[model samples]
Target: MQLVLEKRAERSGTIALVSPLLAIGLTIVTMVILFAILGKNPLLALHAYFIAPLTDGYSLQEIAVKATPLVMIAIGLSLCYLANAWNIGAEGQFLIGAVAGSWIAVRTQGTDAGAWVLPAMLVLAAAAGALYALIPAICKVKFGASEILTSLMLVYVADLFLDYLVRGPWRDPHGFNFPTTAEFDPVATVPLLIEGGRLHLGSIIALLVVAAAAILLARTIKGFEIRVVGAAPRAARFGGFNANQLIILTFAVSGALAGLAGIIEVAGPVGHLQPGISPGYGFTAIIVAFLGRLNPVGILIAGLFLALTFIGGEQAQIAMKIPLDVTKVFQGILLFYVLACDSLILYRFKLVSSNRQVPRGAG
Candidate 1:
C-alpha cells in the first residue's frame, strides 16, 4: 500500500510538470485528425497552420503585431489571476479604452500636438479601462454580485455603445458614411520601430511590461500579498490583507494594461477606430495567460505562440482552403485538453484489486 501510494504521488508530480506539454501535443494530434476528416492531408495542413508563417520576415513582423495586444492583456490578467480576482470584462475594458483613446485622437486631428498626443491618448485609454473595470469589481465587493456574469454582459453593452457613437455623433463626415472615425494624424500614431517595417513601439512596451510584471510578482510586497490572498483568503485576512482593496487594485491594474493594449492596437496597426476594431484579442489573452501558467515570462512565450497561430491560420485559409472556423476549433481543443490535463495534477485514478477482501465482509 505504501509503495503504491508513493508511486501515485510521483506520477502525479510528473503529470503536473508535463500537463502543458501533453495538452499541446494532444492539440496537434486532434488538429491532424480534424484535417483528415475534412479531406486535407493532415501533415500538410499542420505545416501550413504552424510552420509556414515563421519562414519569412514579413510574417515574423506580423506575429509581433498580433502578439502585442495579447501580451499586454495577458500581463494584466496574470496579476488578476494571481490575486484571485476574476475580471472577465477585459473585452469591455479594451473597447472602452479604444473609444477613450480615439476620442482624444479625433479631437486633436487638426492640431500640431505631435508626440504628446499619442502619450495622452494612451493615458486616457488606460484610465478609461480601469474606470470601466472598477464597476464590476465594486459591484462584486459591495453587493455580492457574480462578477463573471456581470463582466461578460458588460462587453456587449460597451461594444454596442461604441457602435452607437461611431454611427452617430463620432461619425466622420468625410468618411462617406463609413462607420469609422477619421484617419488619425500621423503624429498621433505609434511610431514604427524598424524602417520599412510594420513593427511598432507597442512590442517594446509589451516586453517592458512583461519584465516589470516579473519583477513585481517575484520581488514586491504586494505580490506576496496577492499570492497569499489567492492561495488562502482566510490566511490573508489573518495577516491583515484587505480583500476589498486587493480586489480593486487587481481589477484596476488588469484593466489598465488591457486598455493600454487597446490604445496601442488602434494607434499602431488598425490606425483608426472602426466598428469592429478588435478581433477578440481580449478573449484570446485569457488563453494565453492560462497557457503561460499565469506567469509573466511564461505569458510572453505563450502570446507569441498564439500569435503565430493567428497568422498561420490566416495563411492556411488563403493557401490551403481551410475554413477560418478551423482556427477557433483548434484553440478550443487546446484549451479543453490543457484543462483536462491539469486535472490529473490533483486527482488520480485507481484500479481496484479484485482479489482483495472487502472490509464490509469482516465488519
Candidate 2:
C-alpha cells in the first residue's frame, strides 16, 4: 500500500478553525495509551496533568506567571512566522537578553541605584536580544545561509556562554559554590502583583505585548506587508513588499520580545542569573506560536494552556513518579500532532495499492 497526501480542491474553513482542537484531542488519546503501557492509571495521569493545576488559586497564579514568558516569546515568533522568517533560535535570544539585562543588575549589585536600574536592564536586554537575533538574519540575507541551522547552532553558543558566566566570573561568592550570580537586588526586581503571590508585573507586560501585536497586525501597513510576503510571495513582490527586509524586521522584533521575556523571567521569579535560566522556553514557544495559529489573542490562550502542562507535569512527577522528561516528550508529541492535523487542512492522505500497474499511454 502507498499513502499519498492529495491536495484538497478547496480549503475547509471549519477544519482550519478546528485543527488545533483535533490535534489536542488526538494527543490526549495517545497519552492515554502511553499511560497504560507504563502501568499507570490514565485517568489519574490526566487529572494530574489537566485538573490538578487548576484546583487552587496559587497554582492558577503560578500558571499566569509561567505563561508570561511563553506568551511574550510566542508573540514575537508569530510575527517572524507570519513574515516567512523562521527564527528557531529564540532560546538563544532569550539567554542573550537575560545575560545583557543581568549585566546591569550585576554591576549595580550593592549600589544605591535609583529607580532607573530596572528600566535600564529591560531596555538593554531587548536591545541585546535584537542584535543577537540579527546575526542569523544578516547571514541569511548576505550569503543565503540557512537561517534554521544558523539560528539553531547559535542556541548552544548562547547556552555555553551563559554557563561559563554563571560558573566562573559571575559565581556567587557565598552561594555555597553554586553556579549563579547573586540574587538581583530588590530595586532591580519585577514587582509582585499581589503582596506575596507568585504573579508579578511580567504577566501585565505580556498582556500589553499581546495588545500591541494585535494592533500592529490589524491596523498597520507593515502588518499587511508581512502577511502578504508570507502568504503570497509573488504578489508581495508585485505590490512592492520587500521579503528580505521583512525577514530582518520580523527577526529583530521576535528577538526583542524573547529578550524582554528573558529579563522579566530573571527579575521576577528566579531573581538571579543562573546556568539553567530557561526550561526550553524558546523552543516551546514555537509550539505555542503554531498552536495559536500565529494570532496574538490565540497565542495568549495557547501560552496559558502550555503553561498548565509545565505545572501539571511537575505535579505528576511528584505524585506518580513520572519522569520530568515525560513533559518534553508530551510537548514533542503535541507539536507533531498539531502539524499533522494542520496538514490535513490543505491536503489529505490517500492510499493506493502498490501492485497497481501504470496505464498505457499515460505519458
CA lDDT, every prediction?
Answer: 0.88, 0.94
Best by TM-score: 2
In terms of lDDT, the best-performing candidate is 2
Across 55-162, the per-residue lDDT of candidate 1 in tens digits comes to 999999999999999999988988888888888888889999999998989998888777789999999999999999888989989998987888889899989999
TM-score of each: 0.93, 0.96
Q: Ten-residue segment with the worst summed lDDT in candidate 2?
A: 354-363
Candidate 2 lDDT over residue span 240-347, tens digit each: 998999999999999999999999999999999998889999999999999999999999999999999999999999999877888888888999999999898899
Q: Cα deviation in Å at residue 21, candidate 1?
A: 1.7
Error of 2 at 124 (Å): 0.4
Q: Which pairs clash in the backbone of model 1?
A: none
RMSD of each: 3.3, 1.9
